[model samples]
Target: MSNFLLQLSYLIGSITFIVGLKQLSSPDSARKGNLVAAFGMVLAIIGTILFHEHDGNKIGNIPWILGAMALGTVVGWMMAMKVKMTAMPQMVSFFNGMGGACAAIISIVEFNSHPDGAPGYLLVVFLGLIIGTVSFSGSIIAYGKLDDKIKDISSKALTYFNLLLLLAIFVVLGIAVASPEVFGHDVVWLLLGLSAAYGVLFVMPIGGADMPVVISLLNSFTGMAAAFGGFLYNNPVMLTGGILVGSAGTILTVLMCNAMNRSLLNVIIGSFGGGGASGKGADGEQVVKEISVTDTAILCAYAGKVTIVPGYGLAVAQAQHICHDLEKKLEDKGVEVSFAIHPVAGRMPGHMNVLLAEADVPYPKLVEMEDANPGMSSTDVVIVVGANDVVNPAAENDPSSPIYGMPVLKVWEAKNVIVMKRSMRAGYAGIENELFFHPKTKMLFGDAKDTLGKLVAEIKEL
Candidate 1:
């Protein structure tokens, strides 16, 4: 009876997971979706503890399980509440690494207890071990990169070395799969070391510009590792969740690669985005045009249509709320305001949208690149707030540039462009924004929040 009840519980959890994931498709329902899924997970945990039976022996141990879960819950809750919006990506990498570690440890323990397994089962365990270790180490490296703790390192030699290491890893995998009993226990430990090292090597050479894609790909790796765990344990909910995450992460990764105009194979090859400083101008110099907040305020207050483009700089300044405030202020004066959001804006997919949504900005105002480009010329004022690479005109004009083929906002098409920037420094791709030197472009120099505040105050006086 308990076995039957547990199976039924797993079924219910699986259905809830599917429904919850569907709800996550829309921003309005995302919170509810997360809560629903979390509830399903809680149910699964309780059912497993109370009713699970294996080898005709009921599973035991209540205190240890609840204690571990309580600790994790407390830690996770504190981190969620305390982590800054700017550090969200690092936090995501950290949490994803934890999931990968759990999967790897599960596989390791299972393998140690049941080394004499069927060839196919042994293959599943081996795959879980490799992918989980890779995900764990890769996620750590990604967090380091996102947090600026590790610098991008790339070279032709390093690229070749990585390829050789991958080849060696696959060779070892083949041996273990073919003959699981032939190798000593030490061989599995060696496999773990090699995979962990390879994960570091894999992410070390990827540039900051490619971090969103890398994070998505590593997430897929973690999902696949978890799926192997599900296979080992015959857990329906685990399998379903793993499949869902793996597929979603993979699709998101591909979309991110497309947004950046880079191929997945090329990204894995790790030869891009680590070159020397990008050229500033045709002859290494250009005149920078400045505009006063007062004058910029007048222009925005009177424009027929205005579009705001946001980037990582906005995130760093934690100024999305003020940007929304600026938008509302403009809209009240009869200007049609919209936000142009690049797919790869900030450090991850939907980053700009998430930030702006927190400010309670209406969904209709967030415009995508393709949709905003056509209407840009007719727009009167283009206020680029704390953005750099996504709006760089180099993407459209300079074929030799690193970000040449990437799609960028068509702010340059507007009558006048107001670029809010900290300095003349290049963007993440290390290329100078050709739009900055355009005749109609005016640079607003200062911190994004401070500059936007000034603009808001100036506009109010008008």
Candidate 2:
């Protein structure tokens, strides 16, 4: 009867996971979906602890399990509450690495207990170890890169070396699985070290701009590793959850790659955006126009249509609310306001969307790149807030540019473009923006939050 109830709980948990994932497709239902999924997970955990039995005895270590759960819950809740919008990507990478580490540890414990297990069982253990260890290490590196603590070490030689290292990992895996008796227990540690090394080197060369894709890929790796653990333990709930996470991560990664106009292969080996290449006019001789706060407000308030483009700097300044206020003010003046969102904008996928959503911006007003591009020519004014590479013209004009083929917002096509930035410094891609020198573009220099607040105040007085 207990086993029956546990299976029922797993079934309910899996159903909630599916429903929650579906609801996550839209922002309006995302919070509810998250809560529902979390509740289901908690239910599954409780059911497993109470009912799971091996042979004739129930699972032990209840006190330790509950204690660990309580600690993790407190730590995770605190982190989630304390994390800033700009550090969200790093936070995600760090948390995902923890999941990977947990899966790897599970494999290690299982392998030690079943050293003389069948070849199929040993294969699952080895695979879980390799994938989980790699995911953990790679995710840590990605976290460092996103947080600006690590620099990209891009080199042609490094790329080749990474490839060789990957090949060696696979070779070692094959040998260990085919002949576990030969190397004994030491082989597991050796494999762990090699996987960890490969993980670090794999992410070391990937540039900053490609971090969204890397994060998604590593998340998928963690999912895959978790799924292998499920297979090892024959746990339906674990398997379902792992598969859902893995497949969702994979799909999201593919979408991100497509949005960037780059193939997965290119993202892995190209080492794009290492920050060395100069822009079309990086010689400090190009002239740029500047506009004042009053002029910016006057222009936005009087324009028939205005579009705001947000990027990483907006997040850094925590200006989404003020920007929304500016939008509302412009709208009140009979100007149609909308936001142009690039898929790869900011630090992660949907970052700009999330930022704006937090400010209570309506979903309909946040236009995607494809939809927003067609209307750029008709837009009376384009306000770029803390955005750089997404609006740069080099993607379309310069063949030698590292981000040349990647799609960017066509804010330059608008009638008048006002770029809100702190200085003439380059963007995260480490390249100058050609749009700054365009005839229609004028720079509005200040911190995004302060400038947007000023714009809101100015528009209200008018």
Number of the top candidate by lDDT? 2
Residues 32-63, candidate 1, lDDT per residue (tens digit)? Answer: 99989888888887889988888987776778
TM-score of each: 0.96, 0.96
lDDT of 2: 0.89
Task: Find the 10 residues in a row with the least total lDDT in model 1.
Answer: 273-282
Note the clash tally of each candidate: 0, 0
lDDT of each: 0.87, 0.89
What is the lDDT for 454 in model 2? 85
Look at candidate 1 and give me any clashing residue pairs. none
Q: Once superposed on the true structure, which residue ranges of model 2 sit more than 4 Å away at CA?
A: 278-284
